[model samples]
Target: MDQRNALLGEQFGICPICLKPDPEHVDHDHETGKVRGVLCFSCNAALGQFRDRPDVMRRAAAYVEGNVWKPKLVAPGVYRLPS
Candidate 1:
């Protein structure tokens, strides 16, 4: 097997982060163009969503950890906080 496929097998065809089986996408460094590892589509999308910034990712984690928003029930199937 080639290097990419080999890495995919090593990772068991699943995303290391979310541990979900998905078509493999190679993850790499945008700056230096260095190959990092293989990841699933969703996990790869997450890095893009975070703009590949560790600081932004950390802030998002902190926000989730803070749990600043609590769900409020509005209707049978609708739930939202009042503005």
Candidate 2:
């Protein structure tokens, strides 16, 4: 057992995704008491990219779901300049 693992509860320390005996790297949202998930180092870093901003993250999700994103552009991309 990892030294940090002792911090989080025993059985609770297991990561649900990989079901690995993850160390004490439990991540939670600062704004919300939302239990994100138990993750290993890689997944934890990935989650950090979201920064716990559900609204912003949701918008990104909507963009993906609504087909607002484009893939494989050969030429330089053009973006709207903010006014």
Candidate 1 global CA lDDT score: 0.80
Give the alpha carbon lDDT tens digit for every residue of 1-83 in model 1: 38988887888887788888754789988988887778888888999899789977776786789845567878997889523
Off by over 4 Å in 1: 67-83
User: TM-scores of the models, in the given order?
Assistant: 0.67, 0.38
User: How well does candidate 1 score on lDDT at residue 67?
Assistant: 43
Q: Using lDDT as the measure, which candidate wins?
A: 1
Most TM-score-accurate candidate:
1
Model 1 poorest ten-residue lDDT run: 62-71
- Candidate 2 lDDT, 13-65, residue by residue in tens: 67654567754466667678675554677657656787866666666777878
User: Which ten-residue region of model 2 has the weakest summed lDDT?
Assistant: 1-10
Model 1, position 59: C-alpha lDDT score: 68
